[model samples]
Target: MANWVRISSRSIGNHIRKRMNQGFIGSAVDINKSSGSSSALHGGRTVCDRNRRYLNSLPWNRATLFWFQRFKSTVAEKQQDSFLSSDTDDDQLSLDFPGGKVSYTSDMNFISESSQTRVPCYRVLDDDGELIKDTDFQQVSKEAAVKMYSKMVNLQIMDTIFYEAQRQGRISFYLTSAGEEAINIASAAALTEQDIILPQYREPGVLLWRGFTLQEFADQCFGNKADYGKGRQMPIHYGSKKHNFFTISSPIATQLPQAAGIAYSLKMDNKKACVVSYIGDGGTSEGDFHAGLNFAAVMEAPVIFFCRNNGWAISTNVWEQFRSDGIVVKGRAYGIRSIRVDGNDALAVYTAVSAAREMAVNEQRPILIEALTYRVGHHSTSDDSTKYRQSDEIVYWKNARNPVNRFRNWVQSNGWWSDQQETQLRSSVRKQVIISLIGLDIHNLHFFSDT
Candidate 1:
């Protein structure tokens, strides 16, 4: 039995050494013979001291040392006996799988349904737009803050007018960013122009931030000859190569895997930018979402997977979605760092994205941000949310938790804006939208007449 145990241990050690040589383990285990300490070098960081101590307590043999090092875990320290110890209790044993460490037990046990703990949502501002005490955030200058508010207002107005145009049969379809204006604009404000964006259909505010003119938006939505897509894509399927924005695809979750690949490309070329991919809560249900996250995590791609958890995917509410504590936990499942932020709080979203961008670029890793907000508008011109969700819920989000109102309150608290300025900005933006539409109409008419 002793000889058999030795042989098996040697075999396991050989396999581990082979894996290490193939770069699976990245680097070799380093043993400090004089100090009686053992450490593994991975990516230039020392292995945890606990792991070092656990390794040192083992028999001083290559096979034994490699085996423990490969499967080190927090619960491992309790199991100091030989692997073949008949006195060992099943409850004291731990198995370290590729996913993570798990304790083994002889008792019939099952993971509880109540084990899912809701992740805390991060917020810097209250519903009334007052900063919460003891909260920290990246501060924005007055000029930058005002610009963010203006763009959010612009996006809201644009959505309203364009949705009206679709209803008037001037366009085919439209999606509003009503309750999510803060998310749309604040996240865009956090990123640089050099960063690539893979947007779902609802993020026109990003393009607006990148200098995509109202005329350009109108042309694309109208599918005119002047449109960059040359009338091939549908309305709201907007993209601009000049702006580093990928065209929106109708299929759900397709952009996620693509974003991972783009991020990998940027990393290979040593670019100082990252990729930001946006998805709705419903999109998280797709297989592409899993594939994208796993791929990015394994490749260590610099990408930010931003999920707009707006409580509904078309007519299907988020309750009908997966049962695991929302989308942020899915990031941990894939070994990606993640956070949940208040999407209605522009300051919170901006601060979270700013930190996420820095970490993604500097660490060359992926991040998942689950922005908790409510969809105050219908899914699109194609579906009515009122049919499934309560009218009061919509009204509550639109009024009590309105992103525009909350941000305007913050700006007003600083005395940076006034009612007159608000009135003038709204008037100016409304006129601009109308004028852009009229200009597109005239240009199209002239082209047809000449033809």
Candidate 2:
């Protein structure tokens, strides 16, 4: 009787076939030419060479061997032709497989660092707040533009006052969307009232834009009797069912999968709306991010994964987070359409999100947007960003790339906003925030004792 090794061709063939399909048409074993060990042998025979010969000598089906050899030669010849033929369309040089069509490449090269080949950020305005020549963006009417700017200003002032209150020990904790005001307000402006918003802690601007009043925000933050959460949740974990905005949570990336489910629910009900889920660059590192994106893609859910890549996750810098080309590329891995945008450019963010929402709803597919911005403030009241990063870096983003100032510049260039109007808007917003805080303190004082 012959000694027999039960070879599972199903598994082995699948593995080798997958490798071959990926453009690996070379020899199975490589000779160590650099070490001058090409001829080196163990027990008078090279290990790989001996194993190959032994495998070939097995009593296998002749037809199976012939088929594999033919397949290998055919793929190798086609790959060579593709490389040598200048007239061949690059798009045509692809291998159709179970997953998808993979483009063929002759060079065995690993992808370089993301920094060397970073995705270009989409921008409508320069750092000086002037529109880029021939820039394509969704045009905003003066009224709508003014409203967007006012909401942005309102959000900025609210963040400033709330952060100060936290510092003064009036609030237990707070998260300010200081440099990220545009990302919040602009994205909110692009969505309809029917759209669902699943926000991280930094997206109170969405609530404000959706008509959550200053008094409401103050109530929630102060956790007064008028607070929707009734003091059960922490400050800044705001939610308004009336506005279709889900409650904010402290757990990182937990909202991602929830967004997918909500979008799928909307799809099932045949609603003409999509879900917008927001996250920080640091949140993308969570396993929930992958699960959420995969779930949305697999379900063909109408959802937009909005990533605020502000270059930090608390103390962790983005470089230390991942090696990929930021958060946008992760969308591609999950088969979701993605784009990178200038988070500081309000028009750019609004335009990108407007188009993204349309595509997501019409095509019933997931979209990922990475808004590249900087966090000018500390991560939260508990964090001191200066401990981890330079103050000059913060100052540069705060002064040069200030989103509120940039949008104000655009509106002023159009003769729609003036210094007088700016002064009035700032004063009025500050007064509203201050009044709301004062009212909340008085209400809490009486309400706390009664409760």
Candidate 3:
């Protein structure tokens, strides 16, 4: 080591020397099988078995072809633009230098003010409930599709009632996964319940789909004796060790690194499970997101970082999130595999996450997913959307682009669901909420019986 100056001279030469003198930090995972024995037991399934199970559940089954036959014929009369286009474009920054012609440069950004290409958002269906992607559609079985739709609807209904319960002073606080039902349930549907899930506050639907009861949700929110946390945590923060779902934390992006560490531990144990960590577009702004992603990539942690880019961080628009390309680009920076999915499309999210799960565990690599969606409701009860954004903007996403309704139309088109099913499901959900909320007094519940 030598004496180094903290300040540098004012010149490009000094800047170059300064950068070179700085120590380079690295986070990389050595992709190797761990030798240590794992005493912990997983779901009694081998890696190959789980892979086969996942592949079999994909849209490649016989039902997919038959369903598309009827779906295509009905839509043949309609004229629409093709949906199967390349996800990227050829856009380069060229410069005429004194020596010769030069095209892209890593050291210098030739085009500063304008973007070279648009970040592609992956989608399976158009808003009109048509298969827009030219590639063979990823299809779920009719049963699976119907199940996914029901869960999506269930999540929406839960948010509505719980949110109202908060407004009526039944609960101290709440956060609605309103516009994000697809991100919550669809991704959860794609994953095995044994795979660990570390979530921020907005992903309660993951627990709901993993057999967490409606009464449990109410109990946690109301801090009753039945709550796993025993009423010590703030409302809406829930977790279950049995379900392998980690409790929600109010701190943004803190779960990312934790997921990476857990995945690394799973790798050491040679377990076939991967870790999936979820964060919002706003959470990406946190420093933990960077550290977690870099560590996961460098350490070869089998983690999938699911970022729900809902276009707002509290009142801050995504425009304020960052100047660079969206969150997907950050994955590239960390040397991790990444994708951009249509967050509002249940099938698209499910397909993407399912595939990501395979790649993460089998290949022993960290993956990132940037889901494009909008926040349809206020951030939480503490927030008011009208103060920072326009009502029309919210209405557009909430109505025309509601994820629940969009997927419902697709499933119903195949005759898997109908009005009667919808009515019955909604009624059942309402009754569940009523039972959960009314059984015990708001305060002095069993949780309060102790000191």
Candidate 4:
């Protein structure tokens, strides 16, 4: 509503008028008068034109107009900055002044920037096969090694069976943690039966190790009459309250905070149970990751944050996704103790997770374990990995670090397992899976319908 008049030359004004025509100034003045009322202002629609003509009426002095124009712009900028920026600092600007003089100085130089940098990963196995030992490495017993090998083999077979079921059109979708079997099986084997396991989308091997029957898995996958979840969730979103395995969420990293809350309740009740929640490297980018970590640390929640740093989250590699460091170092920011392990090595995963679980239970604090693994399959049955990834990478991983083969060789070398026993176990499990598939009513909607 305030008017701003500036000095300009009469000749320049005359030239502008010549271009605009004779009645322009009069029309502008009329518009300015009508601007006070809504009806007149809407009919005329010439407030901008009136202001230009009024400015043209003044004397043409460059210095005065330039300084005055700058002053007006400065005031407008200050108001905008005040509205837009969070006014947390005390010395920003105090508009409480006599006669309302714009008292602003460029205080941008005084603002402080956070100097924190990412911490590096603490690891047992380096990129090469060399070992980096610390007090953290707990030696696995021979018995534990045998158990680990057996579970890994069973898991591999189970994954293949599920994939075949999906291909046979018995299920809508299936995700096998094909290459990352060591991480899934070994970590679950290390935990107590009472301890809670909250898995992300790909860790079905953990549930299998936790005593989930083949028929139970088949029911859920096929959404059959016996499915516990009533076929409400997708195939891989598994849950078993009896086993203390929390349900899987499609939204990445949401379970992190929920796990922290569960841990807090366990702490309050003075219970021995600790929550072990799994997530991928992609989930780290989410705000929930930071919120969960911070909350767990602040509350001393007995939660183990397991990050499967699987080199790729559906083709977005860790290098493209994060610059700070691997997911392990993220724990340092929240004061939670963390470690990185060779997720391919079953022994290494079991050892690291054993120590992490001890810390969570005995120390009454949260722990983070970043397991470096690879997803051998496409992200899911719905995905096509060949589109975004190189064929050589998959071949290399498949040949070099197949989890089942690695653990199998280790067990065979020690005479813990024999070829005969291995063949018998595989044949028995395969027969069981085939038998379960026969009764699997894939098309029956009774499980999901009305329940």
Candidate 5:
């Protein structure tokens, strides 16, 4: 029996082979080093330090030391716990060299079933309401942040006032983008006045931010004499020749391909403008969706296909619409760069769209941004979402990720505003909305004959 043992698979196999070769084990074998090293008196000797003054040592002890040194190095090289692996097939023994080089060997048995299969959401703002920024987090200027915040706040206030007017029978109908202010206004903030805005009916925030006055909004809403569409279009289907905002359409996704065409025209003229078109998540299921993405990719057209994924199209939830992941992935299949962002965050939406606009203008590539969000209000004044969507779902969107409230929080957190200031701002907006609504009542205005 040995006092200390060094066991190796190779050593065990060699010992077994040697035992078969010999008839019997020797009673004792005296060891001697080839060099003039120590030989102990007793056949079984205690190992001594090699570096000691006794220069001579036992050959067997020297051999044992050499074997162990090699064995320890080999074991250390292969030692890695497989329990912590993110991938099951990997053995997890990784060599971290001086320069950041890594190597891996696959061992299927070491893989675990508990590995994460889905990507966690990438966002700067955490669920706990903390601001997190990193190099990967897209950064925009503070000036842009404040301006975007102001526009979103204004749009939200306007949406509430106008929707309430519709409920009170003061107006025929109105579309409220209550939870969509960040997606609508921040994306508009990302664009230039020269760029074309192909808006779906719910995105009045774009027009309002681009200097469409309250009076102009009222005129369009009322279909009065001052209306830009000359009372030919219905309320809120506003557009401007000078402002570069395209007229809003009633058909589901008509503006999508129209945006591609407009983008093609911009390329034809070698203009600096890029076209941005907004649509609902449900709109991406339409034929126009495929045509728009394909046409833009083929032409290398400068268009930003913005999808506001507000979780519902009329009474239908997003789960009922498609089974093939989100809308952003669909855009990627078209050979267009696509991004998905927290549409509740104005800063995130603005930064994303601004970068997309830059890529569209500089690289001449069409891009798509699917803004993951929810609409707390009805799909439109004519439809009721409460019929299908859970009341709690609407409440979740209204309280949790409310675009208006998020911007307000960002505003206050940054010392850009106070609660008193916010109250005053809301009060001012309400007063202005009332004035604009009252001014729209005109006895001299003629009615539209067109159906």
Candidate 6:
């Protein structure tokens, strides 16, 4: 016997190939049974002290050490009994290291069931906002639905005004979230304020959901003194420590690795939160994307690599971006759970990310989500999408397949909202945007310029 417990039914066979699952991470549980609490061990040394020394002795950093500390704190008495009695997949092993060999199970199996068949994208709401037949509809409360809708509408208003502002030479740059706003707001609604968000520049809806005001957005975009980054960052490269969102970096796929490190820290402290990193389809080409996901998988960091595959990675379509089927397949390569969601369907995105977050935080593991949607507007204020893509394609998405309209339809059908409410909401948001745009830095309005 190897004195180990291999938890069964994993999509990937054994996250730890030999050592940790055998008796490394699970070692604390063995000691936990004999002497409870933070009491002393056989050498009259405190359990915490011994644990720290033991972890430090291994090839683990302070982050891994902290993960053990936090896990040790939360291990329940029932868990101890289950560990003591269970014989689920205990097996001996053999390993060749730099110095010697250890006894272990030579047989290994990968659960191909997860990836063998075609994994369908999860969808709860249709374009008409009607629930699909047999949809285990993840119900959003009236209050939550309203809040999410408000945020989505807010994103729309901000995008329209900001895009116009850029055209009018009021600002140097702007990026409209457009069709992806539902994905942004709904996902944020599913998460707590404490969960760190590493977003692309287009995900201002997440910030708004976390109480990042329109005025703050204005200040940042204008590079005014009131901006939190002190005018150092470019427009839309917003960050708010108070909101728990990392500053948006322009470099593709950089945030994914940073998110991995952040999640590892959270695990070390045993916080009930996960990091969600957003990236575009083209970003998958970056080496950091692979490095970040692979590192998170191996280290068992609690993070979510959210791929906002809006059909294009700034003019390069998804077909040209990757050879694989989609971003979800990449998760299987990384040896973790993943999902493909209907990015235009707010309910679907919310459900998928919520479940992913639960698994990430509770299991201290990583999950990837590939959101299948389209970028309905220009890549930014600089690039003209019309030059590369067809006008009909644009009309199809913006008119017939608008996510905000789809969600609004669902809300109306459920009696959560009405035509009057929708009208009033739109009117209010437009007025509010106008007010915020005009009221911002009124005394120093001249300070804003294309320069």
TM-score per candidate, in order? 0.76, 0.75, 0.73, 0.69, 0.70, 0.75
Q: Which stretches of candidate 1 lie over 4 Å from their true place?
A: 1-108, 114-116, 440-451
Tell me the TM-score of model 4: 0.69
The runs of at least 3 residues in candidate 6 whose Cα sits more than 4 Å from the true structure, single-residue gaps closed, are 1-118, 440-451
Residue range 19-119, candidate 3, lDDT tens digits? 22221111111111353211111222121121122111111223222221111111211211222222234334555455434455568545464368967
| Cα-based lDDT for every prediction | 0.82, 0.82, 0.76, 0.73, 0.72, 0.79
Best by TM-score: 1
lDDT of 2 by residue, 218-299 (tens): 8998999999999999999999999999998889999999999889777755699999999999999899999999998877
- Per-prediction backbone clash count: 0, 0, 7, 5, 5, 7
The 10 consecutive residues of candidate 4 with the worst lDDT sum are 67-76
Global lDDT for candidate 6?
0.79
Q: Stretches of candidate 3 above 4 Å error?
A: 1-115, 440-451
Worst 10 residues of 6 by lDDT: 51-60
Worst 10 residues of 1 by lDDT: 69-78
Candidate 2: segments with Cα more than 4 A from true spot? 1-116, 440-451
- How does model 4 fare in lDDT? 0.73
Clashing pairs in 5: 37-56, 37-57, 38-56, 38-57, 88-111
Q: Over all chains combined, what TM-score does candidate 2 have? A: 0.75
- Evaluated at residue 134, the lDDT of candidate 2 is 97
